[model samples]
Target: MEPRSHKLYHLHGFHSRNLLDTYCSSKAEMPFTYEAFMYPMEKFHNAFSSGDFRGDVLIDFSIGPQIQHLYAAQEHFRDIILLKPTEHCILEVKKWTDSRTGAFDWSHTTTLATELAGKSDQSEEKEIRLRAAIKHVVKFDLNQENLTGSIGLPQADCLVFWNILEAISKDLKEFVRNFRKFSKLLKPGGRIMHYGALNCTFYMVGGEKFHFFKYNESDFRSMLSNEGFVITHLEVSQRKAESDLMDFDSVMFCTAYKE
Candidate 1:
């Protein structure tokens, strides 16, 4: 079914707790949010440990105020350069890094990540390490020629993106153009990992509906291939529960390297 047209909202308010309740809260029947946090951490740890790619810097192009996506990155890379599309995201990411009082508690997710990586009781230390490892949190606009604005930084060894596509892009052509910008920021043969909602129209946060560019698995594969990325691994997980809060059927994650 085609999603009805409506006034799309940007994450202007970017209500942190409301977002947690929508996706991260454990009260929901389906573990969609939990799984979204888990699989990426697992894949990152496994991929790096198995000699997939390791380098000094990794650029994170994920959305929202979340940090669970960076669990394994601290161990593998010396620096994590985050690119944020909004002020709210920059503030939220820095809140956790600065140990601010109102920051969302990510301890549970951190503990789970360590356990999945074959370690126990290391969550606290892992959190500390992540804070130290993040070197830059730069504001970015996908529409700009330089996505990071005036800041000049070294090309990263890997670019990791999460849920960014369905949020900012209104269509496939725009998505393709923005994707090429990401490629330019990475070194030749650098790896890429993208985790995004599949076939989604809009997701609700703070009771506001935000329309997004909707696409499926085929579009995802073709885009990566056409953009000169060699697909190394691709996986999809069904959301597995129904809710009015969101209408996505599944999530898509893939690992690739620029060819």
Candidate 2:
């Protein structure tokens, strides 16, 4: 497998739109990012609102620069730490958090989140909340034994991972090994929100192909169980085939707790 780079993946906000537009191809067909990310977020929102999932620190392990995956849970946590794989990805996120011109617009996603929260599509309020809530954005190396490296981060009450393991791992064993290391970043009984491709081998961004761990729903559940995580919520949505993009049968969204 080739080394994963920003060139092979979508590393900016606007590039993410290509993922939704090109691969999804239709407004009716939910993209993998949307289904896998947004659905779990909606669950987290409701859980937090009802005082079901209370947490002070939330950490995000990202595949790249994208931030939409954290929209639902942003307001619930007192602090948010974004860990990106590369310095380039870190800079990409900073552009938006810093409110620079030409930042990738997340208005659409914020609008959706507002509606989910039983409000009108008030995108500005959502944006303001996200900007204020994101306290730190730092570069992290997932391949390193110390996931956060020299910059120490507290063990989070909740961990969010989206398209991270599947995109970075060369195989299942590597995925599991990295997952174990990542789980250590959370406190005991800390909740996890995981989203990934199901049975997908590869995906494209910027006209380059990148690999994904090929696994099904059963594999995902068994792995979490073996890691001592009790699965509280699991949702798998059937994927629509987009010939030009990566071919996968489903997308998996999971919420689990380390026990």
TM-score of each: 0.91, 0.85
- Summing lDDT over every window of 10 consecutive residues in candidate 2, give the lowest-scoring window: 5-14
Model 1, position 74, has a per-residue lDDT of: 86
Q: Score candidate 1 by lDDT.
A: 0.77
**Candidate 1 lDDT score at position 86:** 78
lDDT of 2 by residue, 1-259 (tens): 4434323232322254455454322244545445534565576566557554558899888666667667667767888999776666677678888999967666666766787778765678788888888999977666567877788989899888877888767677978987888888899889988877688777776676676677888888888999999998788877744555676777777888999
Off by over 4 Å in 1: 1-13, 26-31
What ranges in model 2 sit over 4 Å off?
1-41, 241-243
lDDT of each: 0.77, 0.72
Give the number of the best model, judged by lDDT: 1
List the RMSD of every prediction in angstroms. Answer: 2.3, 3.8
Put down candidate 1 lDDT per residue, 99-194, tens digits, no spaces. 999887887678777897788778889999999999888887665788877889789999998877667667888778878877799998899888
